[model samples]
Target: MASTAASASPPPAGWASDPGVSAPLRHVRAIIADHLTHGPTDPTLAQRRAWRDALYDAIALPPDVVSTPVRDGAVRGLWQSSPGARHDHVLLYIHGGGYEIGSVRSWRVISAVLARRMGVRAFSVDYPLAPEAHFPAPVDNVVAAYRWLLAQGIGAHDIVFAGDSSGGGLTAAALLQLRMLGLPEPAGALLISPWLDLTNSGKSIDDPPGYDPFNPRAGLESFAHDYLAGHPATDPLASPLFGDLHGLPPLLIQVGGDEALLDDSVRFARRAGSEQVAVTMQVWPHMFHEFQAWAPDLPAASAAMDDAATFLDRALADAR
Candidate 1:
């Protein structure tokens, strides 16, 4: 087992000790923490891309997994743990990076874990980012990727969509767009601390300072504006919070209690529940948005992953 303190920096303010994380993840978290502390002053665009790819490789997922290019020549990922009878189900993963960062390579570890747990192959799309690729671009790319998946003989009913933060928002928007286009819906959707409201209308945004460790309120507000770039924030596709939840697939939302986006998840859950969508919202206390990505070593982080796995299992079974 790796030492918890081997690579760890002091816990951020308000973080309590957790015991659910594996030793390997603890080592990973420590390395990430060190990077966070003294690595780069300001990362350039190329550097960010390199960093994203490096983080993915650091997860050290199996080398035997294969990847293929998708729409716009972006890479689409596939991971299968040791050969077995292939399952009919699939998971299409869209990664989070505030719509300006993140890629399939950066989320390989997460995809691998989901693939192992769900007994299904996981596919991650490397969608275009913002500031260069603006509103509707990323969403359009995801839609194209899904269509590509369908073209590959995968049934929509056997697919589940999952993403974190901004990517989660994209997942919901993509589903809505699919419905609009008369395409078949996926079996289920999973959101991790989704940034559903680019408008930042979630009531939780009103919380006092020092509440969320990872996300500074002002920084997120800035990110929203930068990503939207003069577009209307209330557009249902941009902010799923204002969209119609009717006829959407069952959804599982996991959010941290202290996240600024907490209200976004809560409000979405309430609306989805009212619309008779099978919705489960799990809130972990004192954790920041996307805490699992930052502290994969913590017990809470692993528990969150377990929660996601269980949700996927039940939802996929029901879909079957």
Candidate 2:
């Protein structure tokens, strides 16, 4: 999602003439820049959602993929799977809207495409959002969803957790919560441009060196304020970058080099590595936040998804 002019930062260096930049990439950047520049400064929730959905409206699911609504306990989400997807393994995806704006509908395209690529059943969670639910509610909801999956006869080892932006942060938080609750860890987790620091302390937030048209520091701070809702920003669960990550499963963190949250992934990867967790981090040059959502339209997006599939295959190979 993007911010209004009220929260937008000065545009970063444009990539129009950068070496190796593609025509499609330049066009995508222009589209995002124009959209954010012309957006309402005080958009209502409905307006924000519509804006987001329209941005990716052109991206479509494969014809063979099916999206079915399902509810188990507190978990409400869509079950998406393609023809060759394995029924037994689960890919539990949490969408990113800084814990405020995104929904199952807005994220269905990416979720469906990922399920198709990974050859697994995907359950994209519709967790409670902020300025309403706030703080630990989202984390609690995700943990409950994982438990519901287990109750449905899915093995913990056969499940892989994946999410983008704040959802990526929540993925880490839920893994920590799972550890505290004595629940088994999943095979691995994939985090895309994760906003893991509610404190907004990452150096990149203040000093970005590349082009990131979407997520600005002021916008991220506003989101943190609403999501944290008076809670301490440094609380490990709220900002999983502050958590103990020792026993979590293997992690593959893919972040855009130019996004404000780049440091969140770098710092978390450093901490996770120091804690002896198997963590792989990739930084895509000249890219912005959640760029993977662009998929086939953006070469980097497709490559990022391909890397994810490889990571998952390696993680799930033991079970196979």
Candidate 3:
């Protein structure tokens, strides 16, 4: 059965001005401002490493229940409410860092929230970043992690793949790659403001001043150039929006209306519908990418996550 929470109320006008802006929104804005101010000025390698470390240190995660290093050399993280918790259902979480930064630790809160909301354990993978690893490597790591899950006896129907931003793009790409490999599709997938078009074809991406607080056009273009190296942007694996959507599991996509990636999600939904894939797409007005990560305090962010949880529950139930 599908379940949902009431949508969170919008923040008041000029909410950003008050010293007492909601704690979650404050944190969210700080992160965004930091990215904008310091992201481009730092030496590239140092910036990448700092971003990686900050993301890892930001979230408070539950104690590790299991740690498995994949045979292919990627890090596999398992966390649950309790150490001995036996969970058949699994969430394979891929962290987003524009394809250059982000690790399992960086997204601990998001994974933890999903784990609690879905009543399942979550396994986050620390995939290799670009410039060092480049395109296909992250996808390869995600696929390898999925195979590792299967090797541990987790059925495809019991697994739900999820990611935010670049990781979301990777989740979609991984599904396409899985189909190409003749592997069974997972039960469902969730994407938050996925960066699906490295080609930067989305007109919304170039929209005027401050539309998306987090993702700027120039920043994204730079990241894409770094991540893809010399690869063609239109390659289906590199940009999943160009891939065939047939036979993939149900999908839930949440994106901010103001984000440059807005069109990516909209176009993806259109294609998925044409391909007869079950898809749910939500657009939050005036919000930014991955806003749900600031949940539990930001009413809109919390509501968005609650909706995601509800969608995931229904999809998982249907898989069963």
TM-score of 2: 0.94
| Residue 170 of model 3, lDDT score | 94
Task: Give the whole-model CA lDDT for all candidates, comma-separated.
Answer: 0.72, 0.84, 0.75
Expressed as tens digits, the lDDT of each residue in 1-320 for candidate 2 is 33464244435455544557778788777767666666666678768767766666767667898889987668899999888789899899999887887888778777788778889999999999877789899999999999999998999989999999999999999999999999988999999899899998999987775766557776787788888889999999999999988988999999988888899999999999999999999999888888888886888899999899889767876544
Candidate 3 lDDT over 127-238, as tens digits, reads: 8887788888988888988988898799998889889999899999999999999998899999988989899898887772234654666667777888889999999998
In candidate 1, where is summed lDDT lowest over 10 consecutive residues?
1-10
Instruction: Please say which candidate is ahead in lDDT: 1 or 2.
Output: 2
Q: Report the number of the highest-TM-score candidate.
A: 2
TM-score of each: 0.83, 0.94, 0.85
Q: Which pairs clash in the backbone of model 2?
A: none
Which portions of model 3 show Cα errors greater than 4 Å?
A: 1-15, 18-27, 34-40, 52-75, 78-86, 208-210
User: Between candidates 1 and 2, which one is better according to TM-score?
Assistant: 2
Order the candidate numbers by TM-score, best to worst: 2, 3, 1
Instruction: List ranges where model 2 is wrong by over 4 Å.
Output: 1-3, 6-20
